[model samples]
Target: MSAATIGGQNGAMPELITIDDVRSAAELLRGTAVRTPLLPCLAGDPDRPLWIKPESLQPTGAFKIRGATNALLRLTKQERERGVVTHSSGNHAQALAYAAKVTGVPAVVVVPYGTPQTKIDAARRHGAEIVQCELAVRQETAEAISRERGLPMVPPYDHPHVIAGQGTAGLEIAEDLPEVELVLVPVSGGGLLSGVATAIKALCPAAKVVGVEPELAADAQASYRSGVLDRWSAEQRGRTIADGLRSYLSELTLAHLRARVDDIVTVTEDEITSAVGWLAHNARLVAEPSGAVPLAAYLNRADELPRGRTVVVVSGGNMDAELFAKLV
Candidate 1:
C-alpha cells in the first residue's frame, strides 16, 4: 500500500515518499512537535467505537506544525541563512512562522486577502513578514518573493519533506492502536491525508484510510473518484467555511492518495458547523471547521464508512472567535 510504486500516466513515476521517510521525519519532529494522544470519543457506539487524534493540540494549534518544522529542520545551513518563503491559507502559515521563529530562520508568508484575521495575526505574532495577495495568485506571489529574495520556497504541501513530516501523526496512530480499522483524515492539499494514509497503510495494513473534505471544496474527492487530477477554482473553493481546507491537491499528493487512500467523502456546510458545535459540547475540543469534517463524516455518513475502532484526525483548532461563538 506504500506509494513507492504508484504508477504515473507517463509510465514514469517520481519516487514517492516512503514509510522510512516518514520515520525519519518523526525523528526530526520528536521534541518540536507534540506526540498528541488519541483520546477516546465520548460519543461512540458499540459497533464503531471512536477515538480522536487531536492534532489541534500541537504547539501552533494544528498538525501543520509537523510538516513545517520538518521542512525547516531539513534545510541546509546556507539555505536557512538565506531564509524561506511560502504561501498558505492559514494553519500552515502560522506553523511555518512559528517554526521559523524557533529556528532563527527568517520567514515570509504570502497569504491571500480573505484569510481569517485570527490566522493572519497569529502568523505575524510568530515574526513572519506577511505579504497579502489575491487568493488565486498566492503561490505565484510566493515564488516571485522566493526568487527575488534568494530564499528557498517551502511549499505548504507539494514537497516530499512536508508530506513525510505530516506522516508522523499516522505513525503514532499505528503504534498506539494496532487494531484500528478506520482512520478519517481531513483533506485540503492532501499533505496530511497523503502522509497519514501512507503511514497508516504501511503500519496497519488492514486499516482503511479515508479522506474527508467539504462538499463545497471537494476537488480531491472528485479527483479520487475520477482517476484524474481535478481542480476547483479559487472562487469555488472559497465557498467553504473551512478556510484551512480551501487549497487543492498537488499532483504528488493526488498520486499518493490514489495509491494509498481507501475512499474520499464530503460533508455539507450544515454538517460542518454542527460537528464543530458537537465536538465542543460532547468532547470539549475546539475544532476548526476543517478539523471537524472528519467527525461530521462519522456522525452523518457512518453507513458509508468501515466499522470498528475508528480514529478521526482533528487537523486544527484555529477557529475565529466570532465563528466559534456562533457555532458552539
Candidate 2:
C-alpha cells in the first residue's frame, strides 16, 4: 500500500483517543520496548528547567520500536506470518526488524545506499533482510518488495498505529512531568510529532508543540509554510553535520503536522554540532543529528520557552563510532 493519510477529514482525531490505547499498547509490548528515561538538561534556565526523554535507549537504539511493535501486533496472524516490509535509512529499519523477530515474523527493509554501514549492520544483527537502492527511489523499492512477497509495507512515520505508537513517548512525558508547558521533538517523518501533539493536545491542551529540524534539511518547516509537499536534493537537503536530517518529508507526514503542530524551526549545522557535542559531553548522552535536534531548537529560542518546565524528545542515538568521536 501507499503512505497512509494522517488526520484528514476521514482520518482519526487526536482528541477522541483514550489513554486505554497507550495502556493496551504497553500491555501488548511489555518486555519488548524499553522504558527510556527522561534526563534533565544540566545548564539550561534553572527556573524553567529542561529535561530530555532519552528514546535512544530503545532496544534498536531508537524510538521506532514503539510503532513497529504496535503495527506488527495489530496485524492478523496470517499477515504476520507472511512478513512485513518498510523503507528506512536508520532507526526504522532496525526497529521493524527487531519487532518482527520478536513477533515471530520475517521482515525486509529497503534503505537508500547512502545509509551508513553502522545502521545496515545493526539491522542485519537483528535478523532482517536489507535491500539497498537510490535515495529518492526508496518508496518505489518498498512497493516492489511488497508486491513481490505480498507483504504489508510499514513506513517509518506515516501510519496511524505508528503515530500513536510514537506518541507513547509524549504520554510518558506528560506523566513524568505534568508541569511541562512546552515540548520539542525532532522532525523527520512527523509521526512522533503528530503523536505527541495528539496526546498533549488531549492531556495538556495548554502546552505548545514545536518541531526542530536542521536548516540543511528543513523541508518540514518549508512545506508547513507553503501547505504542500517539498522536495530536497542532497545539497538542498542541507550539508548539516547531522546526517539523519538529510531527507525530505512524506505527504502524509506533512498533512498531520499542518493539522496540529504549533511551529517549525530550523537550526544551523553549526548549532547542531554544538548541541550534539554538548549532549555527549555535558549531558552524558550519545546523540546523533536527529537526536540532538531538540537542543538546537532550545538554544535558538531560549528566551521564548515557558519559564518553568520544558521537555525535549532525545529521539535516537544511532551514531557511528567515528562520527560520535568527531562530533564530540
Q: Give the per-residue lDDT digits (tens) of candidate 2, residues 1-328.
A: 2234343445444332345665566667777888777788778777768898999889888888998998888788888889999998877888999998888879999989878787788788888999999988999989998888899988777677787778788888887877778899988778788778877776787888888888778888889889876877768775677666666666656766777678888788888878888887767888887889888878776775544578888888887788788888
lDDT of 1 by residue, 184-294 (tens): 999999999999998999999999999999999999999998877889987999899998898888778888998999999999999999999999998889999999999
Model 2 / residue 126 / CA error / Å:
1.3
User: Candidate 1 at residue 323, lDDT?
Assistant: 88
The true-structure Cα RMSD of candidate 2 reads 2.9
After superposition, which runs of candidate 2 have C-alpha atoms over 4 Å from their true positions?
Answer: 1-23, 304-306
Q: Which pairs of residues clash in candidate 1, taking residues 3 or more apart in a chain or in different chains?
A: none
What TM-score does candidate 2 reach? 0.90
Candidate 2: minimum summed lDDT over ten consecutive residues — where?
Answer: 9-18
Q: Where does candidate 2 clash, by residue pair?
A: 216-237, 216-238
